[model samples]
Target: SWELLQKKVFQNKSCLSELYDVSLEVAKRCKGLPLVVILVAGIIKKKMEESWWHEVKDAIYSYLGESEEYSRGTVHLSYDNLPDYLKPCLLYMGMFPEDHNISASNLINLWIAEGFVQDVESGRLEEAAEGYLMDLISSNVIMVSKGGRYNGKVKYSQVHDIVLHFCLERSREEKFMLAVKGNYSNFRLSDWKESRVSFSFSDGLSEIASKTRKPFHQHLRSLRMTLIKGEVSNWSAFRQFSKLRLLKVLNLSSHRVGRLSSAALQALIHLKYLAVSARKFNFHPESHLPHIETLIVLCPFSRTVLPPIFWKMKTLRHVEINDVVFDLKNNKKWISEESSKLENLRILKQVAIKIGADDNVDVLLRRCPNLQELEIGILCDEDSVEICQLESLTQLQILRLSIDSFQLNVSKLRLPLHIKKLVLRGTRIESIVSSIGGLPSLEYLQLVLPTFIQLKEWCLGDVTFHKLKLLKLECLNISRWDASEESFPLLERLVIKKGHELEEIPLSFADIQTLKQIKLVQCKNKSLKASALKIKEEAEAIGGSDIIDLIVKDKGFEDAKKIITALKGKGISATEAAGFCWG
Candidate 1:
């Protein structure tokens, strides 16, 4: 708590020392509550005057006067002081049930769709919104539940019940968002006619629909129905949404969409975001959802196919599906015409399209030059020259290729110049070092090739992988890995999994200044653990830091740790020989 406030308020050490008594007095006013201390600290972080400090001390005392309700007033004051743009974002967080850990990615996406996020000079709208979330966490408004493994970004965040109560009261007054948590039958929509967003955390959509009268439907811009019990409910009442002229976002569970009408959905021309199960909604060629910018379809079926009309959405910004197939063989001309209209697309994921001999993927990629992230699966008997066409996506940053049913020559794989992360799964690659060496911006790579057999030795040449940070080799048949410090100058994390034939680790890995952690999972090589210990010793000798961690697990790590600790206690410095076995 003090660390967060120190960055915002007490950067001047000398000044903070001069006001030591005042700071200690303020700390005493907190009553050992970290939340109250942090919130109060944030509130007065900008005021540098001595009188202002005394004023805050007096207020904190008065605020905690006689009642517990008054004690919560401090948290409420913090919420009230948040910026106008952040106010709605913070309050919307309360729409989720208490104690729910919200996904940062999904929340940011919803905020963008609701027009709550705005682009700043530093980054995209989502990036700016992430900054807002971090700011909230720093101010002790919300707590981070989990952090991303690779980027250290917040993956999940949670709010306290006290803070959530404040949000609910504030949001109810502003008519920003209404959250219904109890029985749907008793819930009333008469008082929420001016509300712009609505969320239901229970079942019985029919009762809510029965009470949703005419003009009340016109004021809603967003509707989200979440069924905690995962029960199947009738959605025939959703026909009322056809008259929701202002509706922009519609997210519902697949079970609730059983009776969703096709005609009513097509009438939502103003919709910008739509997420529904593919098996529930019937897709036709003439069914045009023109204004949709972000389309997410959850497929519960085996067939991976999308309606032909989806290809022609001109204003599409992001498209995601569980699985999808495209017929570019017979519909080349029309597909090209439709794809050319998607100039604004930034993200396309889970597109498992089958390619023909004459089909070229360049048709889709070349049209969307602004695409930043793409994941597509190519199902073929042999590698197509079309795979090399990805070089046209000059702005592409993240690429995932799932080549099914055949081998693709690793040397022939060509990626865009700016690509930063790459994943190759189910592709037979003989060697990867030579093909990926020249990538200047590549930072993360994962190769999963269970059927691979051609690769025997991976020779990473000098001064390759200049900016690579994370490398994961899983389910490969490689027997040898030859690398030097020059191979991965900036590599920090390395993971080797299911390498049954692998026998050793590169000792020169210790020479890399940035290497921090190495994990060997399910690899039974005897010399691998010895090499890891050697790497740790060498790294400590050169850098005076034994911070490198080697995690090796085949059955259990704790049991291994216990055995190793016992051996060390007995002054027996053991080394690996043959295979590991414990009686």
Candidate 2:
């Protein structure tokens, strides 16, 4: 994991002899382990000041004196050595709960909000922020636990326990942020006089402090509250924090905040990143927050009505919601000639959309021409969502089209050529698959079938999906999956889940050398299981077993177990009886 940093550390030389000596001393203490060496180098690389280098050298000398003992001070040294630019970014991560798998995009957005990332000569501010994240990853400061299938980028990242501990310690030492856990009586505002950021893991914000009570820090820039407990009564406390003119990042996701006063948000003009999870949020008609750039509303099992105040928020760069109905038609006054379009919007994901054509979703998409990723849902039956309108979004790369209509026509839907990943779910149309194979740049595809739908057969013609890498077909009744070797030539992972009628695996799959993993979940087809066994046996016979992994869940299917036993009898590896119960 740290090998990349090791190579750079060993090959890069310092101009000054004294600097080299200090670097060598640190390297020698690392004992050739990549993790330690990389951590040491990450700090050393930023030590351009002679005084700072000397301080670091002295610290390393002290740490080496007690090298025989197992102490976390070694990793803490790396945190102490971080460049000014990256210190806050790493420390901000420690604000999240321990063992949390943070989203790379969210992390970058937060960095941008806190002014940690600046525009470089090579790219925009966000792009530069991404580069900084990559630097940390290369330095072994963060690990990529999940990779994006379509774009081949890091989706989820996590900090190691030792690194996280170091972040907490250094953050306290620097008065970067104050963390308050459990009850509010134990938290004192006077304790955080030097800190501008606060992380509260309190049981309930309502139980913390009264709004009328004087705040400890008037210049607080960031406040993140996680694992909030109980109902919130008076929002007066929140209105008090509105006076924090420097506050930019506020996350209330862990709490069940049902209502918020518009007065609470009107004063937060400097807020750039905000995340809140609630059943519903009310906004004042006169409320205006011009600096808010990233807004995330997570109403997982409920709906959050986005008030009309959002239409005027033109500075938004990214917006994510579990359920929302953006009714622009009702708020025609918000769309004046002077109103700026959402050209800065790069990512928009709406899990459940109540208002469709009436809301003018297409017109909104046209305004957001630079949108790189989009996820929307169509829930109305009479709504005519012109998916072709998406063709105008030339910069769009990822799309998820979800429709729950029983009488909607998608026959004329033409997908954009630039889309790299697409997810289609709950569509009753039978010809959806035929229209999807023509996507030129599509690399990842997910098709989720609706129950009681008429769709049955799926046919992949030759030369289709030329660049496809991952294909997931779920809850389908496609008994016949016809394909050729020319189809999905570049496919790497194929996942078929809950497909009860899928009769057999495609023979052409064995011909694709790029194929690596085939996962079948709750698929009862015996022939399909046997075909998987045969494919493994054939690959092993030709010394290609290393290139393939066949994973299956029988789901209590008797014949599937017999097939597994037969494969084992043939001297092929099988772990079939260990079924996964979906119930």
Candidate 3:
């Protein structure tokens, strides 16, 4: 418990040397409860003075009197001690269901919409919101559930059951928000005056909408229907949503509500964030949502055409569409104007652009000069499509390209110099290594799912990925990997999935001091597994025994069991061997 408390309190354990006795005493007062230790550690880490430590120690001792109420009391103390700015931000997390892995981006967007994030002089509101999330994580109030595949940043986060319960109770007391679950027959909007309402189950949506009259919803700032238990065919409730004139955030992305008419959306003038799943979206941004900032459409099965007016909305910051096709041809006249630029746009994702006689991807990209992240799908039947002008997007940091079925022209591909993360899928280009290796700022690269056939050989000859950290290769048939430690000097994690034909990882990877993890999934070669073990041993010999980890996953249970047996034979404990090998 003391060790865990120290780890939670200080990143470098040496900082606790001076306060070792006091800190140990504080840890012991928690009665060996991990949650209590963590919560107390979070509270006391901000101040290192001996007086503050004693004060915290006394407070914990006073609160943790009963064993049954110890965890709850600690949680309450943690909440009471949180900084004023973080109070609302932490309370907002109760909007999500228990055990729900909340997307960090979605949570940050909601916080920004709710005015919980303060403006930072040096950065955007999104960055400030991210800082707020990090503060919560550091305080141990929020737990990171999953890390991003590329950068290993906190992508999904959740709170423990006790913390969540405390948040729900405190939110109710403060009338900050109300989360409704199961039936809504007894739910009365007039009785509850919270500004935010989250419905865990969607069955009560229509009932609540029909029963709740005007003036009750006028004060509502946020409404979210997170989970759908059944198909909701009666979307007439959305017509009633027009009464929510003061609503700032409305998230109905869980259910596919067939055409949400423009009349219903035009009433939400104050809406800053909107996420919905619909068969078709026909609203005009200029006439309707004039103050909208973040728009997310979650219709993967249907192809939605983005309105040309979106390019002219300066208030718009982030736009994400799943399986969306940009109708640039029909809206050419709208985009042709030189003044129509998305100056404030920061993110555009999964937007399919057709390169033909009418639509030029370059023309559309040039309009969003400040775009930082872009995920585009190229639909071209020709031999190659020219996206060579991406370097014009000086602010572009993350880029993902998905090609339909043609081979990408590697020679003509010009990536942004400042790009940090890049993902290419369904683009069958054999000479991609040379084109991407010399990137000065590239950090994360993922190449997955070639269109027709996997590229047979990948030779990383002399070029270097200077800042590359994580490399992921999926559905590739590369039989030989030729490279040296010089190729990826800063490479930290290597992931290979479905690389059945791959012979072995380059032995020189063992020489890379920064390499920490090598994960192989569905690779059937025994030699590959043996090579991975050898690499682990070599990394241990050079660095320390705890430096590198080798993870193997196979579909066949027998194969995984055999690998586990081999790992145990190498002096690894049964539990550790089982963790290293998964079926």
Please give the CA lDDT of all the candidate structures. 0.71, 0.69, 0.80
What are the models' TM-scores? 0.86, 0.83, 0.90
- Highest lDDT among the candidates is held by which one? 3
- Model 3: per-residue lDDT, tens digit, 449-542? 7432335666666888988999988987677777899998999999999888777888899999999899999987766766676677678777
- lDDT (C-alpha) at residue 246 in model 1: 72
**What lDDT tens digits, residue by residue, belong to model 2 across residues 188-226?**
666665434444554444554453244643647788876
**What is the lDDT, from 0 to 100, of the residue 544 in candidate 2?**
47
Per-residue error (Å), model 1, residue 169: 2.2
User: Could you give candidate 1's per-residue lDDT for residues 1-583 as a string of tens digits?
Assistant: 3444454466555437656677777777767666687777766764666677778778778676544465478787777667878878888886677888888977777777777887565236666878888878766788899985556789899988878888887778877777776567556666764445445554565565566467456677887776666555545555666666677887764343442334568878888888776455455657767788787777656444455666677777788877766666655676677434577788899887666567766785676778889998887645443344578888888999897765455456677888888888886554545567678898988888745454576665464787888889897677887878888888898898888777677889989999899898887665666576667667877899776777887776556656765764575443431123232
Candidate 1 lDDT at 80 equals 64
The candidate maximizing TM-score is 3
Q: Which ten residues in a row have the lowest lDDT in candidate 3?
A: 450-459
